[model samples]
Structures are given as C-alpha cells and as structure tokens.
Target: MITVELTRFRVSPGLSEALLAARSAMLRDFRADRDGFLDARLVRLADDEWLDIVSWRSSADLAASRAKGGNRPGIRAFFELIGEIVSSEEGTAVEEAV
Candidate 1:
C-alpha cells in the first residue's frame, strides 16, 4: 500500500475555498476509478495551506492513474486556479497502524 501526500501553499487568503471546490470536483470524477484507489482527504491549515492525502493499493496503481490523466477539464481548471497559490510536493510512504 501507498499514501501520497500533496502540500500546497496559497497566495491569497480566500483561495482555500476555491481549492476545496476543485477537490470536490475531483472527488466526484475520480472516485469511480478501479485499481484500489481506496480513499482521499483534503486538509486545510492556517490561512493558505493544504495537505491532500490519497491512498492507493500500490505504487503501480498510482502511476497508472497519473498516466490516464483522470478528468482533464476539471483538473486543468483546478490546477490553473490553484497553481500559483500552491507549490506542490508529493511523496509516498508506508502506513502502519497498530
């Protein structure tokens, strides 16, 4: 299993709402994909920062999803709106819970 953590830094104060809206659209679109995407969460911090965490069955599934490009229109608009506000960084890690 793998977890992807995306960090975004926002430029303006009110941009968080827009980011959430974009994420909502993404959830609506990408929730149906196979390959054990599992689940995701969008977390808001401070005035203009967010952490988007996604769980996948494996690294291979994550790569395939990236290659497919999901939903282009919503995604493009989402990126365009929040791109400047966010400097994205991603990583994968093991999740262990006892």
Candidate 2:
C-alpha cells in the first residue's frame, strides 16, 4: 500500500525562506535516489506553523529510507532550521478514483 507521512512543526521566527530553500534542495537531491519516494509537499499553515507531507510507494520503502536517516547533502541543514515537531503521522493511503 502507498504510505503517506505527515510532519507538522513550527518554524523559527524568520527562517521560513531558508527552511524552504533547504527543503527544496534536500528533495531535489534525495528523491531521485530513493526507491519509493513519490513526491512531497511543504505547506505553511500559519505564521509559525508548517506541514510537510511525503508520499512513498509503500510502507517498506518509507521504512528503508528512514532507516538510512533520510539524509542527503542538505537534509541536515533543512532539519536544523525547523523547531520542535508538533505532530507526525504515517499510514497507508486510502485508495479512491480521482
């Protein structure tokens, strides 16, 4: 089954741009080499709140990638710009016709 990972967090006072840039770079560099990585979305909910949603082909694929730390050249810097995670969840996607 497809796996979707959701991570919600609060950003530092004025680091939105930097955090976004890092996230973009990290996805660009990492996704190409990841087996089940489908796509990712970054959303700004409020002034300080943000959400990251990632999709994978399967839960196993997500687990394997995460076990390797999900780190690419810019991932560490991306993580550093974010604050504590407010919530996180992962589960199989519910299939439905578009």
Candidate 3:
C-alpha cells in the first residue's frame, strides 16, 4: 500500500526564495536517490507555514528514504531553511476512486 508522509514546517522571514530553491534541490535528489518515490507536493498554509505531502510506494520505502534523508546534502539544505517543524506523520493512504 502507498504510504503518505505529511510534514508541516515554518520558514524564517524573507527566506522564501532560498526555501523554494532548496526544496527543488531536495526533490531532484529524492528522485535520483530514493526508491519507491511516487510523488510529492509542497503547500503553503500561511505566510511562513508550509506543508509537505509525499507519497511513497510502500511503508518500507518511506522508512528507507527517511533513514537517508538527513545524510543527503539537498535534504539537509531544505531542512536548514525551515525555522521549525510543526508536525510530521505517516500512514497508509486510503484508496480513492480514480
């Protein structure tokens, strides 16, 4: 089953450009390095708050990715841009009509 990993965080003031660039770099690294990465989305909840919804092929894949995320330069850069992480959660995605 697909696993959806959701993360919410806030960025410091006047760092939107750097944050976007860092996110882009991280996405490229994830695509190249992480297995079972299906897709991801970055959503803005407020002026400085944001949400990241990432879908993996399975729970194992998500776990594997998480284990290596902090080691990757792009992922590290992305996190550096975040002032604080508000929340994080993961679960099996509910099936939907397609």
Model 2 regions more than 4 Å off: none
lDDT by residue for model 3 (13-91), tens: 8987898988878988899899999999999888799999999999899999988866779988988899999999998
Clashing pairs in 3: none
lDDT of each candidate versus the true structure:
0.63, 0.83, 0.89
* Model 3, residue 4: C-alpha shift (Å): 0.3
**Local distance difference test, candidate 1:** 0.63
Largest lDDT belongs to which candidate? 3
Please give each candidate's TM-score: 0.66, 0.86, 0.89
- The pairs that clash in candidate 2 are none
* Model 1, residue pairs in steric clash: none
Better of 1 and 2 by TM-score: 2
lDDT tens readout by residue for model 2, 9-69: 9988989989877887778766766789988888899868999888999988888877766
The predictions' CA RMSDs to the true structure, in order, are: 3.1, 1.7, 1.5
- Give lDDT tens digits, candidate 1, residues 31-88: 6654657777777777666666777767777777777674565555555555343555
Which 10 residues in a row give candidate 3 its minimum summed lDDT? 89-98
Q: Pick the candidate with the highest TM-score.
A: 3
| Error in Å for residue 70 of model 1 | 5.5
